[model samples]
Target: MLANPALNKLRQQIGCIEETQRRFSRTIPVTEPVDRWLPYGGLSTGCIHEVKGTNLASAIAFSAILASRLAGDQGNILYIAPDRSLYPLGLLSYGINLDQFLHVSTRKSQDLVWTAMEALRCPQVSSVIALLSGLDLTESRRLQLAAEASGVTGFFLGHAASAPIASPITRWKVSSVAGKPGQRFDKPLWTLDLLYCRGGRPGKWTLEWHSQALLPIVPQLPAKQAAREALAG
Candidate 1:
């Protein structure tokens, strides 16, 4: 006898639930040094994550890269926001595939929550990035549950507001910093703050999200052995 598709899906979801019940769930692998500071040394899945931007552009850029990395090979992204200024060419320049992104807009903020909730529950969807002004803790919790039930990740992107809202698995704040001036194609530097985490302490780091990798932006140092030659010159 053949197994029912619905039944098979339910079994898969059950397995996912078992994984989430553990102290550490699956995370997207990262190669940067900052990985150690993250909850599990990587981006945790099956939970609602918040990314607050100092400005919209940096937020979108930061979130887009993360969404792309999370989606991986076959998953698609559902992005909900009223702002339609998401430039396809720019995203392509940033190494995000244009075809994998689906943009949805809503006039009502309540509709935004509902749409995000539904998207989070779709197994095929890898990530949901919702740009909203405000969301009560109750609504946000529903989204978090949906994410776990579907084994997907959720990112709520918004401007910094007076927040006393739902506790996400992880909360981040990002702001753009000045990059090298004369280099026309220098990647943007960002100040990243770990505002909150489920079981980790909050901290900050400076990183540059290059198109190819997430690199910690560290200061360059002169080689000690070569310093004497520099002084003699």
Candidate 2:
């Protein structure tokens, strides 16, 4: 059997191009605790990630926070929702640049998926946040491929109760946490459960949003009468 030299040369060229793309692609830095669990040490740009929560509101907030980071100073974010209920100004509280965000409202489920895939294919779009009830694994894989080709970050925000699909490199579950009695809590707190992560270990932690960062919450010990209570015996 004889091999074609021209075909081998073409394959070698394609391999070089793919290697170059991997070298130049960027990653969006999440918090230390979260990034530590990711194989890339951060959220890789050319991929899809999912955020699920006990309540959709918390999930939206968490995704918005990630979008804010992904947008950086000059990147543009495309936000696609089922309806026009999203208030763009509300994202300001998360340190997002409202001017850099473009919200698209589509009620149709297929349209939502189509719009997200299109937006992800655009190189100018730094990130895309799609609020959906659910999507099949094939649709998710299409979104992932589009993002990978354009070097864009994509997020699927949905309810944690929904049946899990495929294609996301990481899936996070956020559950709101209440403050202690008579305590003054200025930041939003959540119990984050890493539902699954490809090529990384899953973990759970209690974290709070403070000063534009997600920080792990550490329990405090009382001064005098906490010895027996701390021992839990």
Candidate 3:
């Protein structure tokens, strides 16, 4: 006797549901606080995120925050810098240890994208950051597939004037905010806009460089710290 086609479809659906549940169960929590702003409360392992900005400083700052977060305790970050050099000192100023990060520079944009995909497939790499002059749909799809296979987060950096291609789970646009001129130290201020996201709304928010702790500036400190400072005062 032949099996019923309806039963086969039902079984397939059940199997798919079970596989999705298992995958979600195995997902590791993102180790960085900044990730909370992203959909799913953090960067998903198998997706591509795009960063574009008129302000180079803002773009770099955003990328550094994501990279540092992904590095966590023992993992390493791979940065494919195509146009500008990866400033170790600048990363350190943002409280990121360049020692835990590897910078791979390529002269051409095409090479950078290919290198980024290859690096993402490396099991030892926790995350991959690719600074690209531009990315088309085909390239984005290729990177996305690689990221999914390797369970690595791929960050694509594009110029503000570059044409937008749709492959990113999330797209962000950053801009520089005016800063106080007379301050003792000059720190860059940035505004991050969530241009598009797979499962979230688009909005704009402000962030700054931490002048004291050398970390990405957040709006508020932990509640415990706030309480402690209040009691002290």
Models 1 onward score TM values of: 0.81, 0.81, 0.72
Ranking by TM-score: 2, 1, 3
* Tens digit of per-residue lDDT, candidate 2, span 1-233: 35999999999999997885464236676778777777777777778888888988778788888888877899899889988877776677777898898989988999998899899999999889888667887888888888888888888888888876587888999999996675445467899888888767998888888888888887566755578776775
lDDT of 1 by residue, 163-197 (tens): 63587888888888778766334377888888998
Candidate 1: clashing pairs of residues: none
**lDDT order of candidates, top first:** 2, 1, 3
List ranges where model 3 is wrong by over 4 Å.
1-38, 180-187, 211-233
Model 2 residue 66 CA deviation in Å = 1.3
lDDT of 1 at 179: 80
Worst 10 residues of 3 by lDDT: 23-32
Per-residue lDDT of candidate 3, residues 1-233 (tens digit): 56999989999999997775343222333233435665566556656778888966567667767667666777788878865565667677654677788878879877887798788777788778777756677877888877777777777777788876567877888887776576433356677778887666786666665542223445667899999999999
Q: Report the alpha-carbon TM-score of model 1 versus the true structure.
A: 0.81
